[model samples]
Target: MPGISARGLSHEGRRQLAVNLTRVLALHRSILDAYIIEFFTDNLWDTLPCSWQEALDGLNPPQLATMLLGMPGEGEVVRYRSVWPLTLLALKSTACALAFTRTPGFQTASEFLENPSQSSRLTAPFRKHVRPKKQHEIRRLGELVKKLSDFTGCTQVVDVGSGQGHLSRFMALGLGLMVKSIEGDQRLVERAQRLDQELLQALEKEEKRNPQVVQTSPRHSPHHVVRWVDPTALCEELLLPLENPCQGRARLLLTGLHACGDLSVALLRHFSCCPEVVALASVGCCYMKLSDPGGYPLSQWVAGLPGYELPYRLREGACHALEEYAERLQKAGPGLRTHCYRAALETVIRRARPELRRPGVQGIPRVHELKIEEYVQRGLQRVGLDPQLPLNLAALRAHQAQENRVVAFFSLALLLAPLVETLILLDRLLYLQEQGFHAELLPIFSPELSPRNLVLVATKMPLGQALSILETEDS
Candidate 1:
């Protein structure tokens, strides 16, 4: 008989009704037993107290209804009716809680961010024994390749601008696919060949030296199967001529690993229009090569895009103080960090030695007006190195500067570096899609391993299908 009366329940009555409902559920048991069992077993109820059963057994519906109807002065009994399905729900949700555990292989939010190394193993094969940092990058590239294979169904690959042929050999031997490495720089191409031979000899020697070491070596090695091609001719001549040589047997894969500036854009264009070329994967770097739209002729397609403009240098014409500082830092190489620490020491010394703090006595000069040799001589003189030493101070200074500059510039340009390269890569992807190839942006390496980690994957799906896929993502 306990329930909400016709007059509707007061706040107190509502509370009482809820309590009564709970009691009814506990007493009857059969009323909502299945739902209750399900609720208790569900992940949502994992943290619920075991004493919830006792709280639900003492509710009185009739008294709750009377209080709600405001009939304290009247002896007349009011008809009670069932209100909201409180008892049913109370039975269903006694101990409910949502599960937060991740399925295996799926990284949890915290895990991915806090401990990236947990998933670092996924990339280990690509990086093992090569370089500690390069592993993550190789893994990222592997992920991209897998995604490309799934999306396009094209497995054949060609690596343009293939430096050292390490990645080229990787794709051939690791992925079990045919790979042709094309390099424009004769010296690099030759170096890659020589390295390839040396690697093969090393593997042979290792196998002979200790068979166990061979067993531990990765299945794919730089010595493994990979055809090296020297495209001494410009990309334009190579792309068109290479198409004829393939004889339309398999999809011509045009890929470039860190293709600088125009080289990347050329690959995109080649894959777009050339029917014989089936897929294109290019990761572009060095945007300074792309002339402003008005400065040079871009492909008709790229020039037609809305707001399309020729790319320009970040700090046109002149280097800023930060840039100069970075250049000096990079030339210092691995010792750059140490040199920076030393700079702090120098600052302290400068403060202590007031006489040494001349107006123009900064460690390095900002202007190129004086050759680096002259600057070094000036520095050595200040630091008491012989100013007239017969040593080629110019070359030594230049070399030191160059070594330091690599690391210093990298640290300084970290912010803008990825943006410029990413935009160029996206542009190439758009070009590929426009040319009738299905293209996707994939992370080819970890940011730590290499800042330039994006790969644009394009394949000839149907005539317009590739564009549609790209459009869907854009929308």
Candidate 2:
């Protein structure tokens, strides 16, 4: 008979993985402690578990010596031989994930990622002329619009911040709904009108080109018709004029696609106050523009969480390496190794090329300072290339200041990015919830298309039961 063997991970393998994680976590703790010491100088690790000390105590010098003896003859072979720090880092990440999962928001995040219907309007047309990069997203939006139609029994839509009127045209012409596409930017509004006129001209030209095509159904024809209006006037000066003509028979759709900062909040407020509006499908972006209770606005909702606060007068910095890493990872799918490599290469390039320092190359705006590596990766990606060399932790540390200097100029601004965004989203969600609307955050597109992918979809559910379900999931 064959010898019995233990299934799954061997005892040694399990132990090693755990050890690695523990070591990594310890390193993380050390880093956190150092940061706190530099700032607070007291009670640095007060909240941390003392178990870490006990774990370290268990490792004798003999074991460490034995491990070090097996190292390769490379420059950093000794460092590689020690696994304590790596293990601690891994453990820290695992613990963070576990803790995050316990939060109410965590469950909603998972469910929202898995289920679009949680907050989506079923009636929205997915295939608008906007030509969404992702097919699934477009279909989902279409489904949402369809659902909204059924829920509100509305036949008209008023799209706010409508760029080029692509969505509005699709809904009005394809879905046979009346549409009023509003845009704040005069240039975009002009472009949309021009596009509409061009489409009509193209249709007329096509008819002349092939008279026999007249037998085709109008719905099946390739012709498109869209109407464009000024968004700024619509919400303020034009509201009365527009509503007076429609009277009370028509249900309004207050929809905005990636409306920036305060614009989104403004739309929500408008929807709340506008009794004629029956439904809303708004996606907000640029959280830094939002004003908080103290008048200063942030970009992230997490910044406003119980334990988090916006750092005062913090200047944003560009981390080209991070930005490039984020951008490529987003575009290249979920490849962690690739992302790391790209980030590393970026650092090298930034150190080598100081002249290429400019804004808008990678996502790092001129307003923010960026790390060298981040700049390099972004510059590389902008030119459709990847970093040609390998970069490890040692190399990173060797060039830390050079890498950091690139972004150090805008540290405060950089810190504000995530914080401001998190707070804005939280505020928006809370507002929706307060209004008896069930809202879900969905990744509207891949990270590559835009970093602002988290979309809040809110709909009227039966007696806020959906919110209760979300709360239960969080618990």
Candidate 3:
């Protein structure tokens, strides 16, 4: 990927990043698929060089993610000895791809340092009204909308896939902009409307108690409208009716905090084509759900590459959480052990009852803090198998002795997570830039709090026009 998508970069610089992902994923294909082999099936004893197993046997869970990838040199691996030189090849290659994709995927760190505080943007009444995580997202995203709206002279905000209308309520009630909260689920749309009514009532009651109340806005309009509509099927005609009736005309700022899968892409497609859509700030999630008619490659440039097909497994890998995984590993007791059981049980099912393996173990409720013997017993019951059916615990234990291999295999796959997300986002950013929009990615919220922290912020104006507003507002 391009080092960084500086505003100064040419269109070709941004376009080249489109395929940077395809090439990296293809290069690592064999090494990645190697992870699919069951731990008990092959010792992979031959795959690792001499004494590699001895080193692996010694390291703790928290040390694994960084053990191999962070340290490729002898001095580095000596600290966490399990990583064989040969295995380090794939992990090291993935790290390079990740670095390239990540650097260009967003604005520099200083931009985040420059973001206005949540306290300055949100009033005390509004701050207390929302959850902390939600509060952070609202202020961060809200600031983006403010920039976009001011740049395009837009008076309306449309929150797509606005689940439960948290952001919509914040925009309409707190920011004093007209908002149309579009949710795919009708039940959620109704519930969001009811919640808005309750919040308005509460705010009014508080105003009576504290006459000196520093409201988010004295001009606040309680016009938080809810609509049940699939964004893919929505058009400008539908949007006209949803607009704040008080305004004679309005430019719409289309946004989604974490629009799932193809829904976010669809929003971008609509926003790009629709003349009414002046700007957007969409943060996407649930990449595995992204549908691929031609292939998983969404951008035209990436799709044009021959024999390139992104699988669901690759998208699944993209969702891996490095920070969260490390934190889990550091926790006390058998907390992190839960990761290994499900994969091991899949092997058991293949041997014991292959016919029952069709739908898979997704619905199996977690067997919290169970020993291997008890875990299998409870796990069997979860899949509707007879709990009394005895398994050879001794044999399973022998296989469990190689638990380090399982952790190593997963950690290798986890390395590609951020790269996959970057490639996907880069495609979107490049597409928007190609459309003559000043497009860029911005990180919102602490990554530790929210794994998918990046938001694609863009506008249909000259480069300096939109970003200047962000700088001016900051000053």
Candidate 4:
């Protein structure tokens, strides 16, 4: 079957899909828990489908022990473990969602975009320049910024929440676009400025020493410079160049990489309201912090729909895994247990220091090597509880025996995570469409390298130009 084609799909159609997706996610909403509460909680098992319960019920500890930790005698369970009814249920709901929401027809921006620059080696100089993750984002998003520049004939960019300004520097120096970076943190702004100066100086020294440059006309002139600002707020006053026209910069391509929570929404709002802001290529993270304008149903249609109240933690579930569903099952199982460990400690705390009733502990030392009693006691001490608090060793051992069920519980939550995230992204796309902008979501980077990899790329082009770009997809 053909993949989803966002241009070919209508905004109402996307809305309808969002409505359908909410049902699928809500079906198991009761099973989902905040990661902070996932471990040491027991109700997740109740939310499991009856079939899953039956399958699990059929297995005794001796029978189910192999798959949990793969001990020697328990290997037999692995042999007969072909059927995964719970996973099938999750896949079934996902398939239903895939039918409604179109895939935007492309993964990386490079697929639909023309070569970002005439020169083939745009990222070579930046090879050793930044951290591995930052380097990946710098190249990928930099290419998109360059593509937007070439598309709109606007070489002006505003990088919002420009931490340490790694992306901002690339947009200005590598692409030679006029950049205005706004960061809330003053220290990062200073650091970004210092690095920008150092790099520019180093390039100048190299050019003078060689005298005879390899490339004619100097592909990189170092003439371009980045303007940095420390914004006191997230309001439009800081976005002057893009929000309202200023000298020499009429239309601006507003780009932000990993603008957490409300920052991405603010950019989208700016894109819709401000005409001079011609384009947006933004990636958002930290969903937990997004201030719900009204509630879980952020879009008008989703807001009006029945049974559409989204919890913040469930909204957070959407970002569970960016690459593949299988990743959740294979590698994430151990990490999921850390939450369990914390919750288990919380349970112990409640029992011994019932009056104190300290609900949760912020930071605890690692608990892997320590036995359950030692682990619980150490965790108690870290949280300022009585370190010498007593725990029932045998009973605690029995509680630990239920570790497999906890994994099952988390797996169920993980299944719903992507669907929830998609619903959120789709709602944002629909919101943009309502505001009269052409928008689409794209997995613009390698998920393995960066989990929060999908970017919401949109443009405010005229109908003719927009159609031309969509036609290129078929070509």
**Model 3 stretches astray by more than 4 angstroms:** 1-10, 30-58, 69-90, 93-131, 214-238, 241-249, 294-296, 362-368, 465-475
lDDT of 4 by residue, 1-475 (tens): 1124444567777877777777776666676544535345445556666777666643433333333222225223354455657565455446434532322334444422443332133333454356666776776777777766677777568788888777877777766667778777778777777777776676666667777743243333222223332221335544565334445557767777998777777777777777778888888887776776532345687777776666787777766652343343344434434555665776777676666543656555555555677777778777788888667777777657766566555555654566666666777888878777778776556664566766787888744354334322221
- Badly placed stretches (over 4 Å) of model 4 are 1-8, 33-41, 56-129, 205-237, 242-249, 294-298, 322-336, 353-366, 462-475
- Cα RMSD of all models vs. native, in order, equals 25.7, 14.5, 5.2, 6.8
Which has the higher TM-score value, candidate number 2 or candidate number 4? 4
Error of 3 at 319 (Å): 2.0
TM-score, per-candidate, Cα-based: 0.45, 0.48, 0.82, 0.78
Assess each prediction's global lDDT (C-alpha) against the native. Answer: 0.42, 0.41, 0.63, 0.61
Task: Give lDDT tens digits, candidate 3, residues 1-475.
Answer: 1224334446676565555656777876644444333444444444544555555554666566446435232233435443456645555565654432222232323433534333444555565546656766776677668767777887678888887777887777866777777776778877777777777777788788888874654544334444544545655542563545465655778888888888788778777887778788888888888876622565666668654566777776776666576555445246555545655665666677876552344444555556776776667777777778778888778656656566666665666666677777877776776677777776555554567767787778764655645533332
Candidate 1 local Cα displacement, residue 220, angstroms: 10
lDDT, model 1: 0.42
When sorted by TM-score, best at the front, the candidate numbers are: 3, 4, 2, 1
TM-score of 4: 0.78
* Deviation of model 4 at 229, angstroms: 11
**Model 1 bad stretches (over 4 Å):** 1-130, 133-135, 146-155, 201-248, 291-311, 315-423, 462-475
User: Candidate 1's residue-wise lDDT over 350-417, tens digit each?
Assistant: 43444543223345544235454555456545554455544454434434343222222223222222
